[model samples]
Target: MVMGIQQVSLSADGHRAAVVSLRDGVPSIYLIKNPFERRLVSDTLAPTVWAQRRLRQVPRLAPALALASEALRQRNPFLRDASYTTPPAGPLLAASEPAGSNGTNGHGEAPDSTRYGTLRVDFRNYVFSSAFDEARPPRATPSYYSSDPFAPKDNVDENGRYRPRRYRLYFTPDLVYGAAGYDMLYGVQSVTQMMFSDMLGNHRIWAATNLLVDLRNSDYLIAYSYLPRRTDWTVAVYHVARLLPDYALRTLYRYRHYGLNLSASYPLNKFERFDFGLAYMGVNQTDIGNLARPPVTRTLFYPSITYTRDVSVPGLLAPIGGHRLALQLSGSPGNLLYGRQIRFVTLLADARTYTSFGRGLYSFAFRLAGGASFGPNPQLFYSAGVENWINRRFDSFPIEDLTDFVFATPVLPLRATDINTLKGPYFGLFNAEFRFPLVAALLPGPLPILPLYNLQGTAFLDAGAVWGSPSNRRLNLFRRDEHGRQVLDDLRVAGGLGLRTIILGFPFRFDFAWPFDGRRFLHRRFYFSVGLDF
Candidate 1:
């Protein structure tokens, strides 16, 4: 009954199957489900059949204007083959058209034929998708001229590394480029990070720099990674300027720093990875107004190890399911190795879990993180604002970074507060959020705007506390504040709703929040940020 099978595809669960067969010297498609039920999909079936299909039909590779424009083809020349006048057969992914929808849409069964719209920006997704191309399976692999020639018809570079014209176009490339995007924090930085890798992922390069927004301040960083086999090794060099604000002491400290780092990561199994890192950074303190403080400078050496368990799956906008846990221990032993007197050990734990309701349209996310340190200078915690907050405003609050501004934690989502306002040595934070998709479809025609797919809404709640003030060297939880209240009674709690969408190829979010202390709500707060949720 099934002797002339051309191709067969099985479902992951092995309960469903799609079979392609030759019937009367023509290809046909069929589907089989549980109970051994075979259903005919297309074999001259109904009013629209394969017999009426054109022999040679072209897909809508671009938008209507681009395909119709003579100027565009003259410029691109290669795109001249994209114009399709005759109607083609049904799309491979489409189901049977609705009762009246098939007659007007001659090319395919898509509603309004909106699936062929082009993108405005390249979103280089760094997670889930391997930064490098995957190992090809055993098959007749053919190399095509997919990239546009930088010079007339020359796609190969002097170094022989081929780069694809489209960043998302993955192939056996010599050098593929990626964008990690800019994170804009007002008065801090609008920094950009770029990433690149070879097709097989044997090599990777990273570069980061200030956008020259400030003529007086600048930062530069570069790194290279060898990611062949199971173990990955990376080396990095950096020059940066940092400002530290001590709200308790009512002073601002500035430092210029330089460093070199070496790191390695290896996967332990399918769900876990281990990491080791060593770095040396030096700092020079300068520019104090009024107070004639002596110029202070320090150098330190840091060695760290981390264990991570990540089983989460990628979603349209973020991770949708499973959980992840990371434990890290870092220490700066200037006294032992560099003989500079800076010494400390720090420990941290972070955990995240996500659950999807259905089809990635709705999901729940949860996170819990905490850390502590030992020795003369411990890890300073800056418990303020939300992560990647844009135009973040702060008041004169105390934040003492005794670790030479290194190993500082910027805890987030503590709303009804300004940045650098909260002061502490030890801290804990927890967040629960529900994300729901709004519009998850493509638009018709060529549009100037970045297609808004997977627009999402979020409802979240955050609870966090920072204790152990440096002045008293005592846990603030049991001690009374100047208000004659226990410090633990002032736990920070905030809840908000936000919208998320892609803009200029980056995930951007806008959030509005308010403080809720069980009794009443405080002043409303708003923030705009770029990046995904934890």
Candidate 2:
């Protein structure tokens, strides 16, 4: 059966409902008390339905709402301007100007839009501009300026060139230690030097003083040197007391000299010069036993011309590649000056060359030096050793404990022979060496713990000979001809291998040499020394 409900009503007891309806196309009314009470029940459900719909939409609306809230909080004006569609990606412009301000184009017109310019914001930087000036061109700032308008500055002379400062002081210490056979010598030699230019407030005058002291030998030399700047002339007053080396290895002597010297030098070019000197020297020689020799007071004049040329690549401990040449001519005229007692003339030449094989890793070096004295012999040049020693013992005594000793003269090296075994007025010497890197080249990484690096190996050869002057041929003890003329027989020769490396920025060497000529009856020698090269 189908029924259409026209009206519905709740029962007064709240347990039954009734409906008046037309059923089966008939108008009929019926009432059921408590009908469907247990099976169907209804209550208000609109609020529950609305809450379910809101729960379904929460995920989509939450994030958008949060973003809107943030935008409202920030409220950036740039975002509000629709014309500024693209946000700035970098730093903003620091300055802005009106359309007709000074910051405009060359025609004094502003840009089409509001233009911006960059500005550095450092306190130490300054910007100067002539933008306000319309008629004149801008000026640039200068990098330098003189503090005084009328006086020179920064060591600049009147000619606009730099000159050396007027005052200087320097002090250097030299220490040497060596052992030969059973003899050892060690000492500290210090030199204190002071220089003053523009003496008496005159730029043409200069003065210098050098004082050298040997702590171990009790020897000293003081020299006062004065120079006339315009003329290249120098005058020196000096006093010296020092030992003179005697070729007789078993004996020693001393010399005391005081003198006044006048010298003039002129530079021919960058690498050559001529020097002339006049001196009045008073000399007294004394033996180790305090026995005095006849005194000789002399006034001597000498002139020398020296030419030197050097082209070298410098290295940490030594030069890697280059060559040097020097030639000198010097003469002491015996009777040219009053009270002159000796006369001599000398010519000297020296040449040295260095070659690198592998970009500073390996090198070959050689030196050739020769000198000859003619006329009269005033002083003898001794050869047999390479360097001067502060103390050299005749016997096998310990240098540290020995007290009864005398200062020895400066010894020039002729290497590969015993000390004080040769003396003469003429000499020629040659030296050659091969140097190569050793351990340092083989290692791959740095060694932080040790100061030693760049270990090097060396092989060397040294040869030299000395002879007396023609007038003093009888003093040539080494070799003589049938007519008693001095001969260059029995040339001294030595060959050796060595190790070299730097320690604490200083170069050190150890060498083992064997003499080939045996002129001094010396055997193999091992030497430990300090220096850049041989």
Candidate 3:
């Protein structure tokens, strides 16, 4: 909005209308009276001063005066005289003073004291535009104003909204070289956001050079995002993830196999969604030696679906029951295709729920989760014992034959035992956690300190094992001597506790756990890691 003199007409009972000239735009309260007409007038000389005082944001004269005085002293050396330097004035005097104390402002004296009140205006305008190219060479465009010329008002709508005009330019002689790597990606992405009729739309295209890389091993990925104007859904695609060079980072590390995966997730409701995808992997060698057979290639199609619902219970758990129950179930079935020896299928299932309590000084929260995974593996079981290097307790078992049981092939009803082969196809996972506020009360003020510190702890247990079947597995956990007698135990369990300190917007986590039966398993012990057992 622009500010100017709203009105300058005389009031109904005006006595000169209380006019006061502001030499420096500093307003003053004036009480006017015309004795000849016996009229009385009183008003605040400037309404702007009242608003400025409320914010206390107006720049002060002291700093500017100090800077100017210093500059002037450096040029003339005479102002350094203590008698010539001016001292600071009181606030009242500074607010209601004229620009000069001498006869005139360096020019001359005042004119006849009666013609008109010269009101000084502090006018400012803010103009914002991104269309104009600031980098254009000066010679390319004729210069009119020494400063940037104001945007042409005619190009804007009557209501002042700029009709966006996108401009594109390309330059040659550009050294456009690029590279890519795994997880870390750097590339250029182009996108546009626009409003069409009553809809909002967005489109994006991103190309990454190194999706994965090594001199001998590298990959590239191309992805894009799109949102149409008619629906409340977004579509994304990872068009490609191609390997470029191999054996780049670790020449010693073998390239088991790398492939592509494509998946899409669409929200079914506020609390439910579904995803589907497929991934293919080819391994020429296990972590050990390359197989006598060239290389095994497996293409698996995984179709997954899930449902979620929130259950809210009131006034049942705490002083202020902020309890909610959430449920989720998802599954994936994978198939491996190689030689006539097609492997058994794999399936997984998971579920979890949580509740929150309290609101004031002391708050609490609790959560629980459980999941199971069963898969077939002809090779040794790919599982390792925990190792806590940060805490100095390292207990990791060397690789060994893992398959020790065998049962049968799976059926439609999907009994747990159906997939439990002596090799792999196992199941086990459990988790629970709780949170508590560590503060007693907040300070008294408009901006009060909340529970700046909080304490959270968790207890968890995990157990996994395989069954017996046609999937011939090694007998590591339960081995039989040449006499065919049971010679080893089979069950393993672990329990752990976690202490978390939430401070200043960050969480510090420390966890410690011990085996219920801390004994030797395959000549190695088990220990907790950075608290992330999983």
Candidate 4:
């Protein structure tokens, strides 16, 4: 009586349940009521029920237990308490057991914990923060890798297959031969050029000679030029013997000049530059097949200054956009600076504008140029045909027979008229052109064998006039035609179509032009030449 349970225990056989009670302050041991039945049921069903519950929780508990074990092993403070609440799960159990178990092999002793707790990490520091800085390991500049159309590629190896030589020489031949009406016309022209660096004490030197022979005339031009490294100055000496064609008078005039020239250029900015030059020349002239005029000889000193501003996008053959303006003043005096023969002052101004359309697929360009000469001497300015490095086309039959040909001059093209037919002391010219891509735009495929892929097409109109000096009455070439109209009233005008292409690093052009100023289309002219700017 008056019994209370103090402790409960199970027998070693697990088949009996026992309870210890304090009955009247005296400890007493007693078997639990129906101990055998309870033990039998517990032993048979308890293990299976516990196993089913644990299997259900294994998936959810595995990650948490693994994380806690990892944290304890790594000495992480956040999960240490949770990891200690239960023996570490799975394989980590042995390593995370009680310190006594970890310390010894059935013996009390401390083991090495330092080896398990240490952590090592490797870090890197940045060497550069911006792309513009030179790459520390040595690399090419940004411009060398740029694909911008306007970027310069002076040092870029475009093909990566060939390297250029330090010095080179080039030669070009421009020859023409034809026969018309019992006249066997023939011309042989050639230009031989040699260029080398450091030829004369760290200066670049270029030596060239041009030789031309025709049925009625022959000429030779020799020039030697020098340019110092990293400078804009040029020194040259040249000798030239040329034949001037007179279409009006149907005669050839011999002109000769040998000169030494020194010139320098200064760039004001990216778009503007100034040029100055001085020259001393010995000149001679002889009128051939005509006795009306005597041969004239003179020594001339020429000094010139020019200012140019170009804000144009350069193309393979010409400018595609923007404008350019040039102003020049040149004086040739007989008794000024070291001369005693001819005296005159000349002023010239030229301007050009280019407009693009259709996303640069086409362009319209216009140019205006004028020049005036003053003094008592008969300074000649011819207006008739275009400018060219080599005149491959034949001149009018009578004026320039198989034996005679025209030389290059300051004369600008009038397109519609004959060469050297209009001459005076003052002249002006205007030219307009519409240019578009030809083969490049149409085909646009790589053709290693065909160099004509760079062809460009153009339609152009040219008009110009020359007039006599206002002060000289006798030298006035502007007179009335048979219709009592001023000759100046009938300005020379012409229109034509042309094709341009590049060959051997130079631009070559072929033009078929017809004069519209009272001339039949049958008299149209064909010209083949080399030049970029019209």
User: Which predicted model would earn the best TM-score?
Assistant: 1
Compare candidates 3 and 4 on TM-score and give the better one.
4
Estimate the TM-score of every prediction.
0.61, 0.51, 0.43, 0.51
- What C-alpha lDDT values do all the predictions have? 0.67, 0.54, 0.35, 0.60
Model 2 residue 157 distance off true place after TM-score fit, in angstroms:
20
RMSD to the hidden true structure, all candidates: 14.8, 34.5, 16.9, 31.1
Model 1 clashing residue pairs (backbone): 247-397, 247-398, 247-399, 248-398
TM-score between candidate 4 and the true structure: 0.51
**Winner of 1 and 3 under lDDT:** 1
State the lDDT of candidate 3 residue by residue for 1-534, as single tens digits: 112333344556665554444434554434446524763364333223323334343333322233355656434322221112242221111112233566432223232121112532221232566556776655543332234455443457789787765543322221234432111011232222222221222543344343334422333444443445322232322222222121333212233334455545565666454544444433322221323434333433333444434343332222222333333322223344433232433344444444554543233333333233344443223223322222231122211221111112121111111122223344333434343444334344677655533454555454434433244433345566576765433334445555555444434455554444324323222232222212
lDDT of 3: 0.35
Please state the error at residue 453 of candidate 4 in Å: 2.2
Which scores higher on lDDT, 3 or 4? 4
Put down candidate 4 lDDT per residue, 1-534, tens digits, no spaces. 435677889877776778888876889888765565654423332222223233432222333344345645446422332334343222121233344555341223223211222432212232556766555566455553355544545644677644454553433332323321111122334455655554344445566655556522333333343444334777787766666566777787776666688888888888998999998766666788675887665666779999999998777667889999999998766645552456677788999999888778689999999888787554566554655624433333322221112211345656665555665667888999999988763332676553455788899988887767344434343457687765534367778999888765667778888876442343677766666764
Off by over 4 Å in 4: 1-188, 199-202, 210-231, 243-255, 285-297, 335-340, 389-408, 441-451, 469-490, 502-506, 518-525
Tens-place lDDT digits, model 1, residues 1-534: 233778889898878888898766678888878625646565542321222234334432334333346776434312332333443443321212222455533334332332233312222332466534556443433354334332434466789886555544242324333334433222445456777776667777888777454632577789988877799999999887766555556677666777899999999898999999998887766645435787666778889999999999899778999999999999877735443487778888999999998786789999999888787777677666777777677664333443435556777767656776665667788999999977775564676654667678999898887766656555433446576755434367788898998876778888888876445677888988777778
